[model samples]
Target: MANTKEIQNRIKSIKDTQKITNAMYMISSSKLKKARTDLENTEPYFYTLQVALARMLRHVPEMEHLYFDSREGIKEEDRRRGYLVITADKGMAGAYNHNVIKIAEQELAAHPNSELYVVGQVGRHYFAKKGVPIDIHFQYTAQNPSLHRARVIADKMLENYENGDIDEVYIIYTNMKSSVVVEPQMIQLLPMKRTDFAGVPADVFHEEITMEPSPKAVLDRIVPNCVMGYIYGALVESFCSEQNSRMMAMDSATKSAKEMLDDLNIKYNRARQAAITQEITEIAGGARAQRDRS
Candidate 1:
């Protein structure tokens, strides 16, 4: 009976846990949908900006801009690199945060003279707990990514890049192509290189566009938008990936809970049957002993 009671209690506890997990699964699913919608909505705008920038560059091959040049106005002795890592504000998101952080650490290791900027509470807390230095941390961006927040981060980073406080800028984030497809990507954001414009075809420069003012002026304005777009796009993708990860994690948890509940039910039934068998045996033995005494 004691064993039966313990099994019953465990079964009850697991049922309660399953309920919570199911609820969480549903919640994460809803959030994932919204995040994906936001991601999709922002996708075209950024890609268009990137395309336009590429086209502008192709139009004037000799165009010179501060964006393309890595003129970090500081002396070589004071030169440092900047690395920005995007993660999730909350956990229970599978390997979303883990993957990003792991790669970011690699970036930090690769660039010994690097300053770290992190987006997400998880990254901030993890780094702080590990005593890893972080120069900047945006605590709220992961939960709710916005163009405004992206701009704020971009402005600061661009300023640092321009002033030569940091020469190279790398952004590490999870790129969510779909719910099932999320990959950790580390991309250099500063000193726009020709390779960065891989999206534009090689022969795109064959066409000619009339430059109203000048190609240099046009590129100068468009290049900054390119940077801002990259930052915003990463934030959007990371946000979507985080939500999808949470949803998947919760779904897995719910399924595991169901399996556990099934196993617990089996154990509970076995214990219950054993108790009943023992009770029936004692009753039959007592009856036989009475018959013998009679």
Candidate 2:
């Protein structure tokens, strides 16, 4: 029903939007590939860390250390908890940020004494506007996951745990199961259980292995490195999920824009045809009037 010019303008606007969406999709694909490559490159180191931890635990099955302490003496309701929540720095991704924020809210509701340590700008801004107290000193961007950044975060978390600031530490992040499937997940980071390493096969050796200073001392050094590896893995996984979600969202947008363009083209053709028919009718009427007057 609208004029051809207006429809043409609308078509142009949609075409521009489609270009932007297509560009975003391609960018997200690149990011996702890079993230996966980083993760793959770092996998062996973390796997080795896990194996070392398992071996150490096998050597001293009855050892009691700060890292393995479950803090059973502390009351559940009174114990302070820290949650490291990973979200997106920016969001055009459909429900990626929303899902993470929802899970974080649920966690906070369950644990009223928990402190929120958010990694993304989106999450930080949302929590701030809602008056939810976020750790002011724990500032970090969620754009790119790096080993150095993960190490810094891990050290801070371990320091707080050592200082009795937080009784428990947990990481909330998204895991990309596949290109199209992603789910938000939470895992305990501190006070690790021995059973967690049960699945990892302990090195089999006939000789009795003896640690240099003490098993506890060696474990103390290895545990922090292992913790850093875990944090790094979580960061990488979350980053990949964000990229995957963004890719899907942008792809959908581009397709929808194409559909709109198709429909609009049909309408434009109809409008143009209708205008030409009207002009022909008007010309015929004028000629008929002239003939009648003569």
Candidate 3:
């Protein structure tokens, strides 16, 4: 049995830890809220663009765009694939980064000749430590997913796709449906599929919509925006997922620490009670001995 002072210190330490975890939980909750709001604001425009692209694809069934075309059996350089992996810059968000990196590793195993573009410091460090080759290491974009960073990623991905450096590109990140529901997923970005656009259902709009100039011309303009939107959406979703996971993890930690503090308090009370009882016993013994001696 530990002394009262030791138990008191333990209680204090746990209480301090609980306070830290609670603060982290609140911060993560705020960040997740902001990220979700940003994502919601962009969804309307992103979905509209998808619908328009779907309509375009329906009208131009035989259209041949590089993004729409597959380069399967091209040269060695053209056969190479690229992976744009997004992860948090820091850890303590449970398995958020770990799950993404694990999926990315599985994808890499499938595409052995692929190039890696690591987006977060966590990923950069992880892949580097894992002895995987990294083509690009973006140290800051994972922490702050901005339009400028999205455009930069878009430009690089487009440039490589056009130059036949990479036949296809994929993005791996965590998808957040709710504060308690977050999972890692990988999405192919290049070689845009008909299904990639506006998520239109088959029964929704069978009627063909008119394209202003030419179907090819309109596709040329909208495809880049659609691709950028996809990348941006992934960034936003991954960020929200990170915050959500962090919030939940911190909340759990806070609860666990509180429970621990309670246990320590119980133990502290027991030890103090034992000490008080012993002192009382000693006083009673002294009083009896003195009375008998007198």
Model number with the top TM-score? 2
Show model 1 residue runs off by greater than 4 Å.
Answer: 71-79, 198-216
Which candidate gets the maximum lDDT versus the true structure?
A: 2
- lDDT string, candidate 2, 93-157, tens digits: 88999998999999999999988999988999999999999984345657878989998999999
lDDT of 3 by residue, 1-294 (tens): 999999888888888888898998899888878877887888888688787788778777778888887865676543688899999989999999999999989988877889999888899999899899899876588767877788789889989998889888899988886657897888888988876554575436666577768777888788888788888999989998888888888988988998888888889899999999999999999999999999
Between candidates 2 and 3, the TM-score winner? 2
Clash counts for the predictions, in order: 0, 0, 2
lDDT of 3: 0.85
Candidate 1 accuracy as TM-score: 0.90
My TM-score estimates for the predictions, one after another, are 0.90, 0.97, 0.91
Q: Clashing residue pairs in candidate 2, if any?
A: none
Q: Candidate 3, residue 117: CA error in Å? A: 1.2
lDDT per residue, candidate 1, 1-294, as tens digits? 349778788878888887887887788777778767876788877777777777776666677677788665666555587989998878988999999999978867766688999998899999899888999887688778888898899999989987878887889999987768899998989888865776675434547788668777777677677788888889878887887887788778878878888887888888888989999999999999999999
lDDT of each: 0.82, 0.90, 0.85
Worst 10 residues of 3 by lDDT: 195-204
Off by over 4 Å in 2: 137-140, 202-207
* 1 versus 3: better lDDT goes to: 3
Candidate with better TM-score, 1 vs 2: 2
- Superposition TM-score, candidate 3 onto the true structure: 0.91
